[model samples]
Target: MSARRFLPGLVVLCLGAVLARGIELVLGANHLLVAIGLGFVLANAVGVPDRLEPGIATHKLWLGAGIVLMGASLTLDTLLEAGVVVVAVIALVTGSTIVVVELLSRNVFGLADRLGSLLAAGSGICGVSAIVAVGGAIRARESQVAYAAATVLLFDAVTIVVFPIVGDVLELSGTVFGIWAGVSMFSTGPVVAVGFAHSDVAGQWATVTKLARNALIGVVVLGYAGYYARSADGSRPTVRTLWDEFPKFVLGFLALVLVATAGVLSPDQLAAIENAYNWLFVLAFVGLGTEIRLTELRKAGPLPVLVVLIALLVASTLSLATLSVLL
Candidate 1:
């Protein structure tokens, strides 16, 4: 309302963009700017205090902007190019990964059900956004959400760097590599970056597969909402659960897909929209890092890492298998 009140968020916006643009220059013309953001999130999670949570403070605006910018990159053409079987494969692998991660997190690692579910969604869905949206809807603690984000960032970094090399060594086609990367990688931006580095076809199909993967976030969140409601009320849920916890911006994301499909914006515009979101991704990560305590990650014990590794193995195996079959 007041200028003083608005100052903090404005500062976050400026800092996020400046750091993101700087990283863009350093990375030498690449899309891994999101990685910088993700790294920032991990750093903050380990050492930064709770008071400096930028992503939380600016919640509604940046979250929506990030969702919208991501949406701008989606299109029916990209989906068609990726093909129905490939799309189905992406969905199935992601779903399986979530279920497997949930099982391991709860039964094996002894994590609370809510925390495990948040981690599972973060691992299996679109990364921080999905974590935040699902965490908020399910009323999970900020600490659990932060930990899930950190885990996703750590593994996503590994996959983004490692997958391309694997693709090359295996001598896979771009389409196959893209499908593999898109399905296995935790974040869409990195998948796009890795895919493009391999081939144009890889990039296109990776984007398509990632979008298809993203489409699951809203559905999963809504399902969680229903599950939670049922747990709370001792009855089946309907319209009310949807109203309370459904991620509304995901709808806006779908609308952007329609607009892109219709060719309303030029390529440059689409690129700019994606770049803007990439910057937000960076800021969200930096904000995330600013809040972390390095010692806390250590204290989370080896089990979290083990759980993540198992999920990674499952996802990677499924992704490569899908590639071998589909492409």
Candidate 2:
């Protein structure tokens, strides 16, 4: 709990974030992805010393803070502007993706129950954050958490490039492409990048849609918590248990949304919050990249990958078709 324990890793993350920004400036690449790549290279090629591991582990804290701050960039008005139809589509796609991944992972891939749940939450909600939240809720093994996170991270990297290319090929409008990426992509960073890659309008839509999905993380995690608790004890989870497992950062996010919707923050203040969240995400993702050991990912084998692939393909194609018709 001491600051010293986290200082070393925080320093590394900060430096990595700064370097990612520089790379973004010079090469015109997405800073978040660059941050992840830099962390991966350092962890895999250069190697992280044992002394830094404790601090690096705090990346989740930074990620949670980033997400909460990001809420300032959105408002109820923004969501309302996206239309009730868009909200309905986001809910439907998110729910369906979770169900499909769970079914495929269990019935077809034959993965462990906890691992399947981890993948389901990751694919259905906010990627690594959701995986971590649900993993803890279900008391998943560390290996299962690692495997699920790696699978989601891999897809996030892949989709960042592929979605934009697909949008261009299909000649989809910005709104359609943004909603598609937002609904289908594994993580927020990649979805945002892919959306902006199409157009600013697309980026806004993508962020809003993705946030809608993200808002469901607490409910999903709570459900998993109760299910796993009941499975373990043959008794329902207590109110205290569910409350303890709830993601408090989600409350922070929702509060910020209310504040923003109330017009409490000036445009300058909103911009500042946006900048803070962006930098926090860069630092957090750099830490995320460092955690992804190629050997660890390889241990996940092919089953989980196949499960996600099938789910993504089905969910994305259906979402695209629906958006094309609706939007």
Candidate 3:
């Protein structure tokens, strides 16, 4: 709780963020990915000092804060403007992806329940953020979280390029391509990048659709929490217990959305908040990257990747087909 206790890790995270920004500027790579890559190299190749461990462990705090602040960017007006058809498609695709991933992970692949849930959340929702949120809600192991995250990142890398190519090959419209990518992609960054690679209008549509999916994170997380709680005890979770298991940051996220909807934040203020959350996410991902060990990740084998691939193919194909008809 003391500032001194966290100072060492915070210093490392800040330095990592600066280095990530430098890498981004020089190489034009995604800063979030760069941050994680830096942390992974430092931790695996160089090694984190024992003294810095405690502070670095506070990455979860940073993650929670980032999620809460990210709420300011998700005004209700944007969702409404995306239109009812887009909203319905987003919900349907998101929900179906989660269910398919969960079933494949648990029934077919024989993954542990929590690990499967983590993968489900990652595939079905906003990628790493959803994985982390659901991991916390379900009390999943760090190894599992890392494994799920790595899989999502892998897909993010692949799909960013592939989606653009597919869009061109299919001669899809910008609106259809954007909505398809928004519904099917693993992460927001890749979704936006893929969308814009097609056209400006596609980029805007992708961002809105992805935002709608992102808004469902809290709901999916809570649902998992309740299910896990009940399965652990063989009884329905009481309100008190469910409340205790709830991620409180979600409440803050919702509150910020309301405030932003009411026009309480000026554009400049909202931009500032966005910048803050982006930095927080970078710092948190650095810490997450450090926690990932090659040995531990290897224990997960290739099943997670296979599960994700199947889900992605199904989700992307189905969403694209559906969008062609709807849009």
- Give candidate 2's error at residue 147 in angstroms: 4.5
Query: Of the candidates shown, which would achieve the greatest lDDT relative to the real structure?
Result: 2
> Which parts of model 1 are misplaced by more than 4 Å?
3-31, 34-74, 102-119, 126-178, 187-211, 217-247, 264-296
- lDDT of candidate 2 over 35-106, digit per residue (tens): 878888989999999989988888878877877887787788766775776777878888888899888877
Error of 1 at 289 (Å): 5.5
Please give, for residues 1-327, the per-residue lDDT of candidate 1 as tens digits.
Answer: 444655654466456557556666777644343444444564554433344344345634554566566666767676666578786787788888889988998788798887788878877878777888778777777888877777776666567668878988999898888788878887765676687668767765776677667777768787776677656632333456535435466577778889988889998998888777655655544443333344444544467667878987888897788668765
| Model 1: worst 10 consecutive residues (lDDT sum) | 284-293
lDDT over C-alpha atoms for residue 145 of model 3: 94
lDDT of each: 0.68, 0.81, 0.78
Across 194-265, the per-residue lDDT of candidate 3 in tens digits comes to: 665576577657766776677787688778877887666323334564455445775787788799889889
RMSD (Å) per prediction: 5.2, 3.5, 5.4
Shift in Å, residue 322, candidate 3: 3.9
Q: Which candidate is the best by TM-score?
A: 2
What TM-score against the true fold does each predicted structure earn? 0.66, 0.80, 0.67
* TM match of model 1 to true structure: 0.66
